[model samples]
Target chain A: MTRALYQFLLWLHPPFFRQRFGEEMLWIYDESAATHGVLALFTDGLASLARQWVMRAGTWKLAVAGAGGLLEILMAGFFVMGPAPTAHVAATQSIEDPAQFSGTWKGSLRSRPIELVLAKEGTVWRGEIHFQSPDGALRSAPLEDIRVAGDSVHLRVQVDDSDMTFSGKLVPGTLGSRLVGALQATADASDDLISYSTLQAFHA
Target chain B: MREDLSPLVPLSPAILHILTALAGEERHGYGIMQEVARQSEGQYKLGPGTLYDNLQKLLEHAVVEECSRRSAADNPRRSAGDDPRRRYYRLTAFGRRVLLAEVARLEGVVRHARLRLQTNNPRRAS
Candidate 1:
């Protein structure tokens, strides 16, 4: 029956759907599978296959029908069965060594003061801009999209629409100095705001 | 209940984790990643690429909404002048309803299975 077919599709589709929605979907699936047994899973897989075939047929209604039919099956099962059981995943990295970029440096943008926080973690350098805006209020923006090569630093920041690159050299025991180059934005009259600067060095 | 079920297609594990993490409170991308890791006891880790991709999809579906920047009263960690570094997310009413319904549906399935298993096994009854 239509209900049986719907239960089957729920089983066939990989748990990718649950990942996008919520774990509740997986919980529901687990419950449904437990009640219906392997038959429900098999039915879902077969229905998915049939829909894939119909999609390849190149007709409009059949394609729509295949999609609509599959959807009906999921809804019917959802209302009757509830949520499916779900599994979880974790993140690979953690933020450590927060002090690497703790020092202060001074720079300028068109003669405006740009104070930076240069934190060094081993060799990788993280920089932050700590400066007062034109209104004399302190603000900060992360030096995102960083690329450090040897003693030279190459990075760009967006001010409005133009991307301005900062090319600088590392001065040992001194504030690194760099020149700003302007690049055209997709649109006119927009310029990227230049923020922080730092040399990329390997921490020994 | 039968208007259109296509949008409610079961989500992937990664997407589900993001949604589940946001079920109780709002969190940005990084916060969701951290919480999911903790909830799973570090078993299922989602990389940046996977996390963001799933987030984009969820945003499109309107299941999760971006929260406003935390006010000073809301975030104790806010430094005096530090720019806000985090984005927050929360579940929509529709999303909550769907999640609850799904939970009930699954529970029903589990109850039926338990009954069948017990009834089919005389040893279990004894």
Candidate 2:
């Protein structure tokens, strides 16, 4: 919910401003959102929205000849109106069998053990993730944006300020099965994907 | 080119702290936040709004520039603490000049303040 509002404010910025620093701002927000208070986080985003519109060009580097105005309008439209740019894997990927991922599995991520749980609820997939934090404490987060495409699987869980996304394929080995993919924590579901590759496959 | 950074001199507390944080190496927003607190020993705390507000201005004035994420996290200081790998910002050449100018300007101010206070002290004046 707070993230939804943060994105909404991000959407409110001028097209040019959004084009340059949308993901950057969101990245920073996610980094601190876990440790900082909500008031501090939202206040910064709200003020930036107002400032970006008023300041015009905080980091404007127009490399093109006359495409500035045109690019601004197009980007603005894309952000405000969906449909045209909704071909992302999260939306385009189809689930052949959601039941395949309907069990708890464990794997090593970032050299730390991670556990993920997925359950289908009336055609909808829902689950949570668990991992050991830096302080040697266990932390868990609910799963969101569960996308499955044939053997490809993608799951995102909101951990503190950032979204931890897992993308791997289900591999059938002689010894049971494993979800072999990389788990990455990103600033947003879309925008920029910061790939901290963890190739440890989880076995049920 | 020796640009006149005097107009931008006497940087605001927030901007100065931010530039100082970026002075050593490129950093993400969270890195900057942590650096500011560490440098100031928690005397000065800059929320995200103020940091970016000033950062936007710094970028506008060409005092700062963005760089790739990989280049930032590969620094020697990565082991010093935990700074998440996010979009990174570095002080541009022009930005370094502005920061040095501000620092020099602050140095003079501190010197003058110390001398003035010392002279006003009865024991020191004697």
Candidate 3:
């Protein structure tokens, strides 16, 4: 089953990519699959998808062919017939019930006020962030990978040239308030990692 | 006129690690991955996707080249059991210079950060 899933993920990648690094990738995946859980494999598959997208962006051949359009469609058909990767693994670790996240969260980092408006979407939490850019201009970006696992709350927001990830504990504060315990935010760029800290509070 | 390395300044961690991995000896993809993990103390493990993408970029930049099997044989250090299908890569002269320049640039940033930190926390400075 794992082998079939691995092959399906590999098919999602471009042919030139398979021609070059396919064997090595499979070798590594086999080793990793033996140790890591299903979540990790799914994460790797997502990473492979990102790499394929990058390749398509850089190469006209893949872009023009829609990354081997017919092959991808056939592969997708096969994938639909199989159990989805998401079905096998719980992506988010919900520490606090997502229902408790209904409200507005306001925090300040690097002297700029950041606001989060979160609401429950089925079993998961979804939200948008409003913040001031370096230029002091207001901007709102969709939250990416918002997860509440155990006492930890993790969310990623895309900023220009980088992605800012926040991982910290959720502290139940005074009535109608949720305080972020030891908030640590890391802005990851291709070349650097910049970090910031903030005292976060959300009010219902 | 010389080619400008400025455009490549503040090189991505992946590119820097690849160049650093190839600094002492030419390595195939798997070797490069192992060396980079070792260098980063397992903090930055490059999956095949990330590894090959950076390699493709490096090849395009003319900073790294894929060596032929004959050249690998010339090394005299490579093991006889080395896989023939494995493609080895090494830094070109230009790549070495870029690596050095990037290191220097990073050092400058570190120095500046230190100075600012000292100013921000005078007690720590003392």
Best-matching candidate per TM-score: 3
lDDT, candidate 3, B25-83, per-residue tens: 99877788888989999898776667776776676455787664466667765788865
Name the candidate, 1 or 2, with the larger lDDT value: 2
- Give per-residue CA lDDT, model 3, range A21-101, as digits (tens): 566666666655654455665675668667666643334433445435555556767877763343112223223564566
Name the better of 2 and 3 by DockQ: 2
- Can you give the lDDT of residue B33 in candidate 3? 80
Model 2, B90: alpha-carbon shift in Å? 1.6
Model 1: per-residue Cα lDDT at residue B116: 97
Write one digit per residue (lDDT tens) for candidate 2, span A1-204: 887788788878765346445676777777778777777778777777667654443222222312454555567687876533322333323323546777888875544577888888886888888888756799888888888767667878676666667776665557766776555656654433334443445556
Model 2 chain A worst lDDT run, 10 consecutive residues? A57-66
How do the predictions measure up, each by TM-score?
0.35, 0.49, 0.50
Candidate 3 colliding pairs: A93-A149
| Predicted complex 1: CAPRI docking category | incorrect
What are the runs in model 2 whose C-alpha is more than 4 Å off? A55-204, B68-85, B122-126
The superposed Cα distance between candidate 2 and the true structure at residue B86, in angstroms, equals 2.0
Q: What stretches of model 1 exceed 4 Å from their correct place?
A: A1-204, B1-6, B70-85, B122-126
Report per-candidate TM-score of chain A alone.
0.32, 0.47, 0.45
Ranking 1 against 2 by TM-score, winner = 2
Q: Give the Å error, residue B125, model 2.
A: 15
DockQ of 2: 0.15
Q: Give the TM-score of candidate 1.
A: 0.35
Q: Chain A only: give the TM-score of model 3.
A: 0.45
